[model samples]
Target: MKKTFLAFVVIVILLSCKQKTGIVFPAQWQNDTLQQTAKAKANIVNNLAIDNTYQFDSTAIVSGCGMVALQKISKDYRYELIIELILDSIPKYKQFSIVDFRDHIKITLNQYSKDNKLINDICTDTPVYSKDQKEPITFTAIEGLMTITNIDGKHSPFKISLTTNNLVFQNADKETFLLPKEEFKDVLVGWYAG
Candidate 1:
């Protein structure tokens, strides 16, 4: 009886120790699911306001490498506003003060000809214009800030919030153009480079 009880106990222990097969998930499927979840969570909010006046709820925003471009054109195509930013490196999640990162940041506004054949005028950082134009229209970021909220991957989705004070630029023809304070909040931009 003792031997039989011991044998029964051993069998019970072996049964309890037996490993059960679990539902196995493929590695690729797991990775894909994780990526999908991340992409879903990183929602893109495209909102831009200039001087608290001209508001653009949805604008075409694109980015590549260390550059970002935000463009808006009128329905009639008579007016166009393009704000481009060139950074020294890939933007990460951080806030950059225009005053300190002035050298590393380059912003530009381009004006095309009536037929869109040539770039008739441009307002940009002093350095960019200095190379091409004898007297380039230039503007400075007196008071501004740039905040990068997310950078998923090298060629993935990202978000940025940009704000600047009044910007003044003088054209080659000695015309003064004033760009009022601008703000871009939670703008959804994508990186297109590998």
Candidate 2:
């Protein structure tokens, strides 16, 4: 399962290497399902939003690693994006896989204006988190960050920050940054909304 997840991430990264401003949806995602890759990615994260204890995960916890996507979801069309990952299953659900029983992260674009929301709570007809597995995966986190090591034997660093313009890679604190716009525009994290 870990190997498969790694392969998927590699494939997603390779496929996303297109021209600047390119917004490639996951190859598995049909255009009918999600018109906008970023928008769909954000909307698809609803399932893994909570744990059995009914506690919601935070954007900081899920940032870094796996398939990451930043979408716009406000009334007005605002150019924006940020990096965030899924959490709660810090150890078991370390990779990007639908069958992992954990979905991705939902980021609230507090850094941007109110015009275009990041579609954090946007709804979808299909289920994002996979239930094909019987036993539920569990994980632990400290200060909203995953405390367990990933399958790659490392933890993802929270390096990106959301702005009114594009996804920026910053230091640990996200207080400083640079433009990953050209690179990010072509990054496709794939989709698992079914």
Candidate 3:
């Protein structure tokens, strides 16, 4: 009985040897999924303001690596963007991605501006990139307070701030700067709720 059972198992294995079973994903498919999810998140994020909806754009993911996007949200049409990334994985001792740009929106608050009031106006300094570009699309500070108010008076106000550095580079030894090759790096990290 043992011999017969072993022989049956061997025959079954041999019969199934030629059967190929594997999972193969499309090129950039994961990246595409990440982008899709990001876009969905952006849709919700864009509608955050009661009076103003933020306009989100994708900059760079990783200079020849991953995916990224930019979110611009503000009151009075004040321009601010945040960078997001979706990568296969970060290699050992490697930078994720980078975006560079030369546009910024400054915040000028009213006289009654308090710490809470300034939260909405503050945004993380982020970079923007394009296919044919090398430097950032917007150059601005990322670690500060921002106050976003409802221009339509239908929504309340809110604030946001980044207390740490959140910029990602291409790799170690390369100066932490933005590059326009891999993915978009322009995004809105967070906003206030009011």
Candidate 4:
């Protein structure tokens, strides 16, 4: 009886361990915390239209190739954004530094169909030289259906797309209804989960 009990306990323990490992996600899972954070940071440009109060660090710039790390405050519930500033400092030419001339700031929004086909893409030229330089870009949301598409991949069966007539961006001399910083966190949380 004692031996039988011990064996049973071992079996149960082993099964539990296997279950935990099965649920453990690899480092690159799309919905994983890291991916979510990167998505959230990238989504910051969208958030900017909602809230202008939230300011990003000059070092939080994104590059064509870079590392983005994310942390989940709640499981698929809330998240924090952290960015490792990697500026491309390579010399493009003998006279000018590549990093110095790169577009330092950019704001953009995009929508796609369920087929992974891009429907619309809008972006503002990011200003690099002056902090006070105003961006004349704006985004407006249109009322419509948004669809996500399945691209060739072994990952999640669905990608994200947006459709709405409400989104809009325009230049404002003072704080306007379209530009508020308080909506940043909530907008991100919704987009991250949606």
Candidate 5:
């Protein structure tokens, strides 16, 4: 009789205890923190306009037989604008130096798009230099939408065309040459994720 009572208690205990359906989520998967971060990053992209601090650094250039890096920085982002003029078919004479007798093209970019009712676009400044570069020759935007000419350099206005992903170099005459965008995936807006 005692044995029978003990068995009954054991069954009752098993029935009373519930089995846990465990599905553990890691810390990174936490929704609250993720939502907050996403919201912040979105705002950064939206409000990205040209900053006064954006300037070209001649020291940050990287050049080789088939590669050239035009580095630009602002309070918002850092980019490597490349102009691949010489193709592989021809031997590299300038070591990818095609712009203004320099290894890489001279360009400074603001981290944000311009604030001319088009905060969604990116602003670029091409530092055109002649015999002397006391001041930048021209301030060229990405879409040719805005052009700022400097009296120090020539008035040749060029534009960046992304429709076919073509980067063109023009003087007073339009479409004089095409500088291919070889590699520019490295875009870092320091405030956001790397």
Candidate 6:
């Protein structure tokens, strides 16, 4: 009887140890306090408007491959705007219209709604989207201006003003979306290995 009781106690201890070591959560995922603080600092002010009808706040900035991309999503996650600018060198105060860099710039607007379940994906250029897709619908920016200022380093604050107009979507049924203007001031910039 003494031997049997000892064996039972040993089995219970092993089972408890196994359960405790089953799942391990990463240290970063355990708390999001740092992430929230970082996000608030990155997007100090984000005001985006399209055709004076749709308005959104700036979300985040992601950078890679000599380019910095600004993203804005609606509160409902129904609309997303991505503007990618390729920069070879840091410009303290550079201003250019959309027509100036037809190939170097990419502007994509995605709409997700119940009516259009798939997604209404449109862009000013195609190269940024994919290199394998045979055909992609491209848009034309008739008039627009973008300015970047106060770029010091990877973590320094910067400002960007983007105003676009008359984005013509080329598809079976051509549609035109009006100006999408956004201004971001004193926003922090960062880079990761992504």
Please name the candidate that would achieve the greatest lDDT relative to the true structure: 6
Measured over all alpha carbons after superposition, the RMSD of each candidate to the real structure, in angstroms, is 20.0, 24.2, 20.2, 21.6, 17.9, 18.3
Ranking by lDDT: 6, 1, 2, 5, 3, 4
For candidate 5, the TM-score is: 0.19
Model 4 per-residue lDDT tens digits across residues 42-153? 5344344233322223232222111211111112211112211122332211332212433421222221122331111111134234343332233222111111111122
Instruction: Estimate TM-scores for all models.
Output: 0.37, 0.17, 0.17, 0.18, 0.19, 0.45
User: What do the candidate models score in CA lDDT, each in turn?
Assistant: 0.45, 0.33, 0.29, 0.28, 0.30, 0.48
Instruction: By TM-score, rank the candidates, best first.
Output: 6, 1, 5, 4, 3, 2
Model 1, 36-83: lDDT tens per residue?
A: 977654431121122212222344232232256554443332234455
- Give per-residue CA lDDT, model 3, range 103-186, as digits (tens): 232211111112111212233344343343232223333222222211121222211111112322221222222211222222
**Candidate 5 local distance difference test against the native:** 0.30
Model 1 regions lying over 4 Å from their true place: 1-66, 86-100, 112-155
User: Relative to the unseen true structure, what is the Cα RMSD of model 1?
Assistant: 20.0
Model 1 clashes, total count: 0
Where in model 6 is the C-alpha error above 4 Å? 1-53, 57-66, 89-94, 114-142, 154-172, 186-190
Error of 5 at 155 (Å): 39
TM-score of 1: 0.37
Candidate closest to the true structure, highest TM-score: 6
Candidate 5: how many backbone clashes? 4
In candidate 3, what residue range of length 10 has the lowest lDDT sum? 107-116
Question: Candidate 4 has what TM-score?
Answer: 0.18
Tens-digit lDDT string for candidate 6 (1-194): 99999999998887787688753335545556678867654432222122222445555332222236665555554555566766553233666666667676776655555332222222123334333323323333334566665455653233344444433222233443443455545433334332
